[model samples]
Target: EADIYQTPRYLVIGTGKKITLECSQTMGHDKMYWYQQDPGMELHLIHYSYGVNSTEKGDLSSESTVSRIRTEHFPLTLESARPSHTSQYLCASSEGGAGEKLFFGSGTQLSVL
Candidate 1:
């Protein structure tokens, strides 16, 4: 089975702070994605990568940035956090084929006060 882990499950930081949401997978999947969602709303794709050194911003525009230096790690960083940036950040990974099953991490709940 695939496994994905996210660090700092719950984070509360003051405005203008810098934070990085960590996400990693043990399944060695080739595709990884990051999504953001509110308490009750549709998920918005914020970033994704096909492989190491291949990163792309998703459909939804975001101020955060992601890096894929290795296969197992994909981290999202927000340089200056704000209240508008508060949301549940979900990390997912899947194989390189179409319709592949996605393994999702528990997610990091971030709150900017």
Candidate 2:
């Protein structure tokens, strides 16, 4: 089984609500990332962390934020839900060396009405 885990496999909420997406890995990987994807569209990197206490914003402009306090946990939070924020969020972890494949979570699909 994959070490990474994401909660709330699916979410439906009204606009203006705050939500937090949880992600965790048991593989002890040093590199973790969060990706945003839309139906029939490419995945976009939204956030990443190289290690505990190290977090960085990715190429995509996202209203969401992430925090990495422990090596095995990385959670993303949206301050306020919006229709435009509806999409699939994937959490992945990888070993830092070259040629290491990323292990992704099942993903969380969010919908805002």
Against the true structure, whose lDDT is highest?
Answer: 2
Q: On residues 14-108, what C-alpha lDDT tens digit does candidate 1 reach at each position?
A: 99999999999999998999999897799999999999999999989999999999999999999999999989999999986427888889999
Instruction: Count steric clashes of candidate 2.
Output: 0
lDDT of 1 at 53: 98
- Return the TM-score for each candidate structure: 0.95, 0.95
Error of 1 at 70 (Å): 0.6
TM-score of 1: 0.95
RMSD of each: 1.2, 1.4
What residue runs in model 1 are displaced by over 4 Å at the alpha carbon?
Answer: none
Q: Candidate 1 at 65: error in angstroms?
A: 0.4
Candidate 2 similarity to native, TM-score: 0.95
